[model samples]
Target: MTPLDDGPPHGRGREIWLLAATFLVAAAGMVYELVAATLSSYLLGDSVRQFSLVIGVFLASMGLGAWVTRFVDRAVSGFVWAQIALGVIGGCMAPVMFFAYAWMGEVELPLYLFLVLTGILCGMEIPLIARVLKEVGAAAFRFENVLSVDYVGALAASVAFPLLIVPHLGLMSASLSFGVLNLLVAGISLWLFRAQVSRGLVVVWAVALCALSVFLVQSERMVSVVEASLFEDEVILSQDSPYQHLTLTRFQGRTRFFLDASIQFDSQDEYRYHEMLVQPAMALAPRRQKVLILGGGDGLAAREVFRSADVAAVTLVDLDGAVTGLFRSHADLVALNAGSLNDPRMTVVTGDAWAFAAENRDSYDVIIVDLPDPKSIALSKLYTQEFYAMLAERLSATGVMVVQSGSPLFARQGYWSVVHTLQATRNPFVPGGRLWVLPYHVYVPSFGDWGFTLVAAHPLTPRDIHLPDGLRYATPEVWRAAQVFGPDEADMPADVNRLQSHALVGYYSAGWDAWFK
Candidate 1:
């Protein structure tokens, strides 16, 4: 009878353990990919660059491993033993990779090298499993069936990881759990395929045990090293959210916040920047009763908005729930902002800013664009004409919008392109109105001195400016002078940028390209 029949003493039951081993291997291997991609983005600044390169490197290494599988002795014991080694390495993948760069500083070189090594070793598992699965049946349902099931397992893991695994389990726990799964896989293989194992397999089991142990003890150290390297201070709080690593660290009594690898704020002196961002838009806005705040999860900008008693409703849209939730939960933050997040008038929505804004239109009088600098394409879209048109649609004819435009002197094209974009959106009624460009600079501890450009639909005269009684940063004179730019920062050429087709990105590239080089 065939192995499919349940009546057998050995046919199907024996092969069940082997196939389960195969499934675990596929799951574990894919987890390795996820860990590498996610961790690199967390430790490094650029998400696109980190994810794409690691995927390419891992795939190439897997192919090389598969090719090398041809020459090795195809003993099932030897193959299983090597898988144990891969698990051990991959077990430490997150913690090791997390701390690797901070400890060594050669993150690029050894990171890719370890990735290739893990991929090669991981790739070796399926081919060897297929060979063993072939031992059962030969004529019709044989090696091909086993291979197809392996593919199905891969498909399941790919879906489960981003949706079920990451958001639910987070990094440290997920890595530890997968490490246990891999070890469990090795132990089961040793039991089910006992006749196939060797004396050398003892070392393999020992290594997996060691990795599991290391993952438990030293993972916190990994985070500290990563935090220290990424931020110029001691890390106070760090979390691996489904979306990114949420980190709050301390330097010189000032607390700094980060998402993934990008600095969100240095809380000690953020008031200077937040005050400028919100007050300008609020002052010029025809009515302050209805307001929309985009991407100001820190609530510092929201705190500024809450200052005006005239405001009736404040709608805050930020992507990460963790950020806003922290603002709501932390006693210090809530007290600092006068519990602005929990204020009866405030509404917090967590999700993508682009999608959220698209769904709601013409809903508010004032919109505050308080986002990080446009470092990647995701952020660049917010600066696009399409997004600006949405903002313009939502604006009351008398209503005004202000964006936290990046540094003009640094990304002159980037700064001016924003202005050009605001002008480019063609509507029959509002062909083009008036534009007022106010460029200003502030010192941030993490980013050093930075710049922003404030624009308005109507001519915003100095006579139009006013602030609440409790402001610490801006006075009437300071507000007027804030619009003043120095000789070098002011002398932006005519060719610096054209409307709609923003030269800001190119300008920013030229300015910051040297640091990357």
Candidate 2:
């Protein structure tokens, strides 16, 4: 009865535009979801928790949005409005959240609100498009065609998110870029159906495009503004690696490195941390000829490994090449680690430590796990029974492995969880019988009362410990003293960390939360 119902002169051509727009809208929608989850993980930590919450809220909001569309009388107008809303809201979501996290520190409400708003807008997309096509008498716009293109778009988004978007554009720019895509699609729709779409609506789309354009252009400078609020010192270098956000800050000749806003080490006391992590295991091992360093991409632990005359070769397996590359090339990092990453005897394999340990048939005399804390599921897997078993397989009979357990006082349960999990690897049913684990703690100024666990095939005591020369912080006496714990620091038995449960991440997050509060 309407001109649209009778079909435009170019009905087939319009259908093609609708299908293409459908594909892009679906892709852009998925990008928004991923951006929110990733940003939340970067700021809040516990990646599993952050992603779970974001996905749950986003999907639920999408459902609600779809349900609400049944009441819409104007399909074409609704689609245009939804695209504009999604573009503006989703495009600015990352920058707003980043700024909020750095300054306000209350992101939960705004985060969810944006997620719900964007999800609702995106939820209306496919349904409204389908309705518009039906109104235009385009019978080819079936549910099957719509869903299939949507899925393909989602697949593209998932692939591009890690490989292309986050790596090149960073979160802020990526958000704006996607927003611009949504606006561009909306503009295209407006131009194609100008006779149908209101002039007032065109103005709205135009204004949103201009606003998003300005934000995209200034995204880099805005990142610096956000970084200044989050970090204490002047941020000299920043990078968004595939694994995490890496930032280096300098203050008064001292430098600090942070991964995902959590401090890895400060130049002033990192030697202390590295020495405690590396020396004790090397000292206790019967032979330190072949050493395996897991997750110490900065190469400080390898520097300590090279200090021993016993070490023949060192193999370092760290996940992030960005981190290893930085430590190898940066003048400040090279000086700090004393160019350990460049040493010919040290072989750097930038990949998952789990895979490296599982695949490598060769045995190592000492294995040092100087990995970051199990703040996320991915990192927590490294502390699980499966991973420890893999490490045990590659360890020589007389080899000793050292793990940089989190602060004993701060993350008491988490520290002990690692201890229990490492012991579990030696389960009698499993191939690698049992391991002798000795837990030790040291008071580092930068990180108070840090912990380390030494796992050996045979029992080890203070007398078995050997100290390398030129050690600044740890001596044989200091190592022996570290074995002593106060009543408050007494070991609390915890469940073994496993890939299925990720109990360690919960324990670690809880423990650290209490400490900070």
Pairs that collide in candidate 1 are 413-503, 413-504, 414-504
- Encode model 2's per-residue lDDT on 1-517: one tens digit a residue: 3437333446877788989999999999999999999988887787888999999998898899999899988888889999999999999999999988888897888888899999999899988888878877786547888888988999999998998888798889999999999999999888777777888999999999999999999999999999999999999998988878999999999999998888888989988888988888888888888998998898888889899986779989988999999999999899889899998898999888888877889988898998888998988989999888888778887788898888889989999999998877773333657777999988888889899998887776558466867989988788878999998878897899998998999899899899784
lDDT per prediction? 0.70, 0.88
Q: Which lDDT tens digits does candidate 1 get at residues 236-312?
A: 77776567768777767677777766677777777777887788778877788998888888788899998888999
Model 2, clash count?
Answer: 0
Taking all chains together, each candidate's TM-score versus the true structure is: 0.88, 0.96
Model 2 pairs in collision:
none
Write down the worst ten-residue block by lDDT for model 1. Answer: 1-10
Q: Find the candidate with the highest TM-score and give its number.
A: 2
Alpha-carbon shift of residue 28 in model 1 (angstroms):
1.6
